[model samples]
Target chain A: MSVDVKTVKRVAHLARIAVSEDDAERMTGELNAILGFVEQLNEVDVSGVEPMTSVTPMEMKKRIDVVTDGNKAADIVANAPATDENFFLVPKVVE
Target chain B: MSDLTRLTISQARAKLHGKEITATEITEAYLSAIDRANPALNAYVAVTGDKARDMAKISDARLVKGEGGALEGIPLGIKDLFGTEGVHTQACSHVLDGFKPRYESTVTSNLWADGAVMLGKLNMDEFAMGSSNETSYYGPVINPWRRSRLDTVVMPTTHQGDGGFVSAGGTKTQRSLDNAQLVPGGSSGGSATAVSAFLCAGATATDTGGSIRQPAAFTGTVGIKPTYGRCSRWGIVAFASSLDQAGPIARDVRDAAILLKSMASVDPKDTTSVDRPVPDYEAAIGKPIKGMKVGIPKEYRVEGMPEEIEALWQKGIAWLKDAGAEIVDISLPHTKYALPAYYIVAPAEASSNLARYDGVRYGLRVPGKDIVEMYEKTRAAGFGREVKRRIMIGTYVLSAGYYDAYYLQAQKVRNLIKRDFENVFAAGVDVILTPATPSAAFGIADEDMAADPVKMYLNDIFTVTVNMAGLPGIAVPAGLDPKGLPLGLQLIGRPFEEETLFQTAAVIEQAAGTFQPEKWW
Candidate 1:
């Protein structure tokens, strides 16, 4: 299954990455080549195998619902490229 | 005392303890070495000289009081992936340009707590994505080791009767012609190069697939990627959550063991970090593996493996057998699918994790008329080519129409691959051994690998299975290839059993001896 230019453009949009016409054209070939390689997985019989999410078989550790750590808004926003006071400044999302 | 920068962690530790060398003196030696060599090697992206001195001063005070930590005053390099408080922690990507974390990563914090001084943040492949360090936005780190050249003068041929000398071969005589620049493999290439070139005593590195071990193999250093949850991944840049692990790239097996002991710890921040007691890994070194059952998987003997690697594998078998360890042949049928499955799972996780890098909160942000347009433009400009390719692949696979065929299929195949390891381990196989890489490191941006992305991904062939299975694996430099470049043998251990790997790898390291490149930088 080759990924066409239309699908490549759509995937780029879905990924929120702006792809130029030339980039989309090149991506069609690159994505297709990668897909062509990954298609080899179809040969393996994984009919009854359960999908694994964690490498170690353990439950997520649970604790009482309490605030363990926080209140360092200054630390969190220190690395923000655009910040106004304590709040991170971004392009206005609200109309 | 020939070069204080050449001291390994253990040697430096002893000297510092005995008061023969102060922490400040050793730190100055490494900083001077980095100053001299970093221009040619490009190993370090950021050198924290002031902080290193301050830390060393504190360590010196502790030594004066006759109280010091495990790695008292030892200088080391931190990989760009690990976040240092108020330091450069961009993971060598343009996306996180100028972003410095206010908090330190758990691994680095642990190392500092053990009295290890930070020399600098080392270079790496951007976001730890590429096999070679060529994908670094800061520029490819040229390895310090060049092919050894023989000192030969192409003397001009002239008869005694002739007054003037004439060249027999053309006048353009070549001296020291064999210094071809070889690549120190990635994504821990910087750590490997820094350790191999004596810029640092030991360096912190991370491995999602073969990042730690492969680079170690290429640069003739020792590295270990402990079990998935062995080290806390709290502040390290997340590549693939389940697969990513922090390890050490050091000068030898003993140094790697010492570093890993400090690096691994349970942290509340990263819930995946196990609560088990971090073992004394250094104690396991030089222990006899006399009756250990070492597994040799037939599946790793892939088609067209290099003759030297095959010979090296056989040589490893002989070394272990001679030491009274039993070698057993094993089969892992699902080995072939590990790479394909990993590409899917890693990208899927990367796409999700990288989604935070929009134009809103931090790092590089491009402006546009609308918010959506801003996100599109920011990501376009911020991410590199390989990163965008992974994002696109991830989005396509996880998209509504193709989720089952790609993402879910890959996950199920991942289970099968893990099961193959489980079966082998259940059969009482103490450890599994294979070549660290299918071949030694290739040239930076070599033509054959540059043509196709998958060709470069194939570099992880021998080491990815360990990651897929979530097992501890160590790479020990076993022999030199035909070009005199080092090749390594990988030892894979059961989950949370890094000590066994340390003990077994010592056997190979003992036989192979240590490999260091001739000084070219």
Candidate 2:
């Protein structure tokens, strides 16, 4: 679980952030520190312990399966940065 | 006229009903106050003066027609994280600098239906990432109470001191301090500051991991995070889907109740929203808390919590006891694991939620020679360092080979934490009492920022457990620290039992006495 500079670099790339070689070294150190602290959790005895999803014991409310969106495609797309006649426009992927 | 700023929401509503003052007058007063105070505090991302005035005019017409809602004509500040139709709803990030949703969030729509006037969009941490408002693209907000005359001498010693002194000492000090602004409690800091400064009556705020309550505590306001699904998240920008819940930030418990009632409803658009009937939250207001069972968790007494916070916690418990509530010692054995589990679960969800903002949607887009370049360059330039760091960490924790080790394990640990609370509640504990945070706000400096991020993450130790459990919690101003900054007492309630939480909070608020910061204006 040690986060090295290479792992840090890959993570940055995956996250779409540009990290310089110098900053990558620094980030690696910080990430390692965080992981080191998190490593403490390994010592606790959790055998037979149930993972909690919520503090309350109530079940999540189930909604009816239905599509009820108000047909506001034009309104929704009005906020998009770039749009075509009826769809969001982006750089050509197939070219 | 200035004294009107001191009136609570309930009192203001009474006056508006009695025809002693028009909604237009109240709206104008708050708009003027926001105009006068916002330049220094920077609490609002956008002020809706025209919208508020128009709403006020309508409210007056309703009054003339003998048709008014409970919160009619109350000016409200909507957090920028909540989508508003035709109003710029930037999430304190340059990426969405000019983006305005064509539809309003359900919470906003509810408030509008209740006749609440929109004051503006409040500022927040970019995408609600940071614990301090310094991460906001619009810059940090200053706590207004710190600007009061009585706080001037003691304030410089606290996190808010520098900004408070500089803003009041005129242009020279203001110019210098502007270069080195202090940190505002993040995510909901702007909402807290606006309420504390009397710039607005109350504001809408969201909490994924103590975002609303922590800031409200730091700024000495009252904030509540309702039970999950109690408030709709449809128009809210997603941070961590499971943990995110919207609530109200107000000057007192009554105001918080008023705002919460108007905003809570079952929304068809939000699949996660509860179908349960919305209650008359105000009906529970001022309800007696005598004979209630209050639990004091032993595990929340972390090692090296400031002595002041410990004293405040004890004082709050003592007050509840005096108010006819029985105090029982409870243990949340899984408390220590709560923080670690939350960091994992929250980030994993955030990584997935934020994937939609990859320069192809509504945010900033950098035109490049090709697709890959466009995605990389755009995101790299659009996001700030802290945001990038979080996104990277989140992505790593959820990636292949790491999922089982981190994300799944965290989920398992989260279950244990939830069970701990359940065990306590089953033993007749109605609510748990704890300190909202370990210490008061910290300074905004490289040294301060350079400290290990986990150390900063620990500040949410007492608050995060509630969110992890999907329970409702409120942060009420307990007392001031030695440095004269506010400290908050946290109240944790069982699932969807906010009525009990608010009643308990009111009893504590009454017993703890009122906080009166010295006025600068």
Candidate 3:
């Protein structure tokens, strides 16, 4: 389960993190080391064990699907690096 | 009394209630200490001096009216991970540079509601990722403690008095005064530093796989990570939603209990925050542990564990036994797999949790020709190396082909680990005891640890199993290593049974006297 540079590049792309060739090369080795450590999990027999999503087993509490709070667009956008009026300004998506 | 800044939370509360000192005076004392020590320690990234004074003034007024809350007039530090309205809440990372939330975290709001004053936002491992606090963008938090130098033994000198050159007693015992800057452990490193250095009465910290307890152990403070659903996570930045639980790092077990009582509450906003009543955790202190069963897990005896840590564990066992508790040897077979499984589950959740920070909304935004390119540029520049590494590891494991092999497999292993704790508890084991960490705090920016991420992740080895089981764990400073640095012993309790942990930890604290470093800063 060794990670190669090509796989590292793909993961970076999938993660939306721009990685240069040099960074990818270094990441290949680092990711491989992590995978090597995690590879030990293969030794344990987990055939009957259910994957635990939450440690405490409780039914997810349901709520009526209604917005209790909103409409304060200014407050939501207060920390935006670049917000125009009520909308967050970003590079044009359609263009 | 002693220095006003050195008062524990209980001590400060008594003084404030007795009108021996005003909240304003104590807050000023802490401010002066922070001014003097923060430059060397870098523990606090933002000091709310004016805000602290304003809050202290309000507390003083409340005391005058004979109507103050539980933690009235006590100043404390807030970890950067918790959101403080209009203050620095970046989690010590560049991604959230200049990002201040309009809302305060539930934990801090609870503290403020109890009349606790905020000293400032403390530094931490960036996004609570690293073990040594070096991952913090602000810089590494220099531990206030350094290894004590060996005592200088001097020979007796001859003195001539009336009795013609008789040998006199002149043995000089000089204490070691070495001043190398040791690390204050991580994730909650800033909180531990502030509390250990007496910069704050206590601090609010979150533990996702040992972040709270490890740092507490390293800095010789008391840290308790309450049960997973004990504290409301609303407004606290999400890391791993299932594992992240907020607790406190304080100067002692009672202070930790006091802070935890104020910090834990059920919130409608966080449905996972259980509706159980928050108990008087401080009251649990001094309760006898006679006839209680303390389980010593066999699997925690990993190879290469330092002799001091093992000795400390033995000392803790003896102390608990002397306090009238029965020691039982238990086997948590899944302990070894906890770390590997934790790495997967934590990162898998982190990658999802951190996806909110793109170029569009809040935080650092680097523009590019297109929205897609803009996201890549912003994230590339925004995140630190360790953060980026985790994101990539997360992305790779969660990718289309590898999901079952890595993410799903890790989740299954996590279940086994949890089941191990349940089995032990079901067998009449009241609480579990183990070392808090593999070793004492290492030097800041150790080259070997920084080079390899896996080596750094190993720091949480002792404390991660508690998180995997969603149980409460406390680190009590038990003894000093041969180097004179503090070493802590951990006690893991059953789910939602933080009271048991508090009682047991108090016994350990009573047996092993509190550790305080000489004033070097």
Candidate 4:
């Protein structure tokens, strides 16, 4: 299925990346081309095939709920563009 | 001293141990080379000269005590995707504006623990999204190798008669790349270009779909994508989590083995890491491949195959034959579907992995009225066009209604493709061989690639299947095309069977001999 300009806008919104009118329009054709190319996968019969859950076959290791590593509040916000007292600052949302 | 930059990693290792040369001297050689060439090559985004010397000093002290680690003082380039603690680790994207990671990636830490010196971070495609390094924000890396114009003046022109000259039957002018720049290939294009031009002894590279192998093939270097989970992924900027893997790009196959030995390890941080003993891959070189079964995948012989690449494949077969390996024709029936399925699976994972890049945590931020608008504006200003396109495609595929028809179906096709390699290997095919790329390097900002993204994706045609199968693959420079650009032959190995790939690749390197671009840059 080809994505229209509206779908492109919706996808961009879902992805949380703002697209201008020009970018959305341009992406419509670009995304359609890629989607069209990948549409060839429909020809393959995937009967009885399970979607790959992991690249390698391994059981997920369960760990006891414990603070294995911690006490690095400063390092977590070390690269944020705006931070104060090791807390990331962002645009206010709640009233 | 002038020739110090030409020495391979193995060679430099010998000199360091023998005390014939100091680590500082070699480090200086590379630093100066990078200083001279990086302006034209654009391979290295950050050259950590002082850090290289400091690390070299530590290596020299260890060598004085005869306690040097595996890589002992050898300088290497780090792909920007790797997080170097307190160093520039932007992945060549504006999204990570001025970001220096607080922690180090496990792979880079492994190299450092082995006494390898850091030459600095290399450039890459923004978030490893594109095939050509053209997608990088810093700028596309210019390949050192260029087409020789001796026999390439193909266009016919007619000139009018002048006072002293007669009308020409058909005039021809020499065509050279005086202004044309060839791409080094990507997303590890910087790593490949640096290694090929000797900007670093070897470089850390990652492969999601052909990032490592494609660039290595273009630059006449050697690169190996170890089996998935072979190298720990912790601290690396995530791309497609399942498909992304860490490897090395080096000047030759043996150097690739040497670098990989130091780069791979199982880490507690990365759960997917394989808990297998890391072998001395350098020891695997020069090993006999007598009676080994090499599979020639019939599907790899794609239509419009270049004559030179085919000839190179034939040459590789003959060399392996002479080396006592039996070439067996095999079929990977789901091969053609691998690329299309990859377009779905990679982007879907990329979309999820890249979600962590919101302005709330780190990097670039654009002010907005609300939190959501802030994220939207920040990401819009930060991510490149190709990245946005992939994220959008990924969101579309994983969105409410289209998930099963697109994402799930692609994953199933992925399983079928993986099974194709499994069935072939189960039939006693020790390793599969194919051309590394359909053609050699193309021009930077090539007009055709600008018009269609699919054309750029086709560059990874042969290399992506290896990643899909989570199998080990190596690209070894085998021959040069008539244009004088390098072409490579790929060897696909079974899971965790990197030793055989190194051994077989060593055989090819021996037969073909390694090539070097003439000093032009």
Q: Candidate 1 chain B — worst ten consecutive residues by lDDT sum?
A: B157-166
The order of the candidates by lDDT, greatest first, is 4, 3, 1, 2
For candidate 3, what is the lDDT?
A: 0.91
Which digits, one per residue and each the tens of the lDDT, describe model 4 over residues B194-253?
999989999999999999999999999999999998999999999999999999999998
DockQ of each: 0.79, 0.53, 0.84, 0.80
Return the clash pairs for model 4, or none: none
Candidate 2 on A1-95: residue-level lDDT in tens? 78889999888778766678898998888777667666656656678876645544445666677875778778867767789875888788895
Candidate 1: lDDT of B165?
Answer: 32
lDDT of 2 by residue, B129-200 (tens): 877777889888876555211332322332444443444433222311112344557688898888888878
Off by over 4 Å in 2: A49-67, B1-3, B147-182
**Which tens-of-lDDT digit does each residue in A20-79 have in candidate 4?**
899988999999999999999999999999998887888765667888998999999888
lDDT per residue (tens digit) for residues B132-170 in model 1: 888888888877655543333444445231322335552
Q: Mark the 10 consecutive residues where model 4 chain B has the least summed lDDT.
A: B160-169
Name the candidate that leads on DockQ. Answer: 3
The estimated TM-scores of all candidates read: 0.95, 0.92, 0.97, 0.95
lDDT of 1 by residue, A6-85 (tens): 98988899899999999999989888889999999999888888888888987887777999889999988887878888
Model 1: residues with Cα > 4 Å off, grouped in runs: B149-177
Q: Write one digit per residue (lDDT tens) for candidate 3, span A1-95.
A: 88889999888988999999999999998989999999999999999899997878777777799999987899899989887878888776673
Identify the leading candidate in terms of TM-score.
3
